[model samples]
Target: MDFYVAFNKTLNRFDLKAIDLARKTDLSMQRVSQFKDGFNVRVDTLQKLLEVMPQEAKRYMLTLVAEGETDSPPSTGG
Candidate 1:
């Protein structure tokens, strides 16, 4: 799955919106939405998002990275 798809799923799983995430990450809502829409996000932005996200979100993000490295990403419920 795409990073944005997983990201959106994480939000959905946690009952969070882009605006809420933006507020928590100290970013603009536009930036958060951009991530959801698959825009290229900066490392700092990614870091900020992860820092503020729930453990499930962080785990999902790790899963995405690990899958990318292994060329066989897992498909699991967010």
Candidate 2:
């Protein structure tokens, strides 16, 4: 399953609206909207969103992050 799909599913599970979540997490409304619209989110922004999620949903989101990190190419230092 796509990470964004999983994210939205977790949000739905908690009956959370994007606007409310953005406000609660102290993130910009545009940022949350962009995430809901499937724009790739930065790690720090994702962390902020996860921090506000319920424990169950947070665990699922972290699992997705771990999986994604495994799938990414390793960075080459300059």
Candidate 3:
């Protein structure tokens, strides 16, 4: 999943509304809305908000960042 899907999944699980996330993460409501809705999100804006995400969410994000270089999943079948 990309940033948009990731953000929405976390928000849904946390029962967080866009407005709540905007304030908590110090992001503009428009930015958060755009991301959650699958719009193009700026790297700087995303990075700043990511700084304040929950530990679990941030961990998930770290995994994504670390794996960004690999585009395909490993083959499983012999």
Candidate 4:
């Protein structure tokens, strides 16, 4: 899944709003909206966003990023 798709999924799962996330992450609403709209953000900004998410959501987003980095399916160990 695309980063934006994962991000939106996380937002939906948490019932979070961009304005609320901006306040929690200390990011501008514009930046958050741009990210939600699929624009790439700086790594530091992405880190800030992740920091405000719940652990489960953060892990899910990171897993997607890791999978994208490897360009392979995630291992499913028996």
Q: Give per-residue CA lDDT, model 4, range 1-78, as digits (tens).
A: 677767887788668777887999889999999999999999899888888888988887777665753235766879
CA error at residue 61 for candidate 2, angstroms: 3.4
lDDT of 3 by residue, 3-75 (tens): 7766676666556577876787778898888887889988887777777677787666555545542235644
lDDT pick, better of 2 and 3: 2
- State the C-alpha lDDT per candidate: 0.77, 0.75, 0.70, 0.80
Top TM-score model: 4
lDDT of 2 by residue, 1-78 (tens): 455666776677668778877998899999988888789999889878878888987886556555654324545759
Worst 10 residues of 3 by lDDT: 66-75
Residue 14 accuracy (lDDT) in model 1: 70
Clashing pairs in 2: none
lDDT of 1 at 4: 75
Poorly placed runs, candidate 1 (over 4 Å): 68-78
Off by over 4 Å in 2: 63-78
- Model 3 residue runs over 4 Å out of place are 61-77
lDDT of 1 by residue, 1-78 (tens): 566777777777678677877999889999988989999899899888888888877796667655753234465858
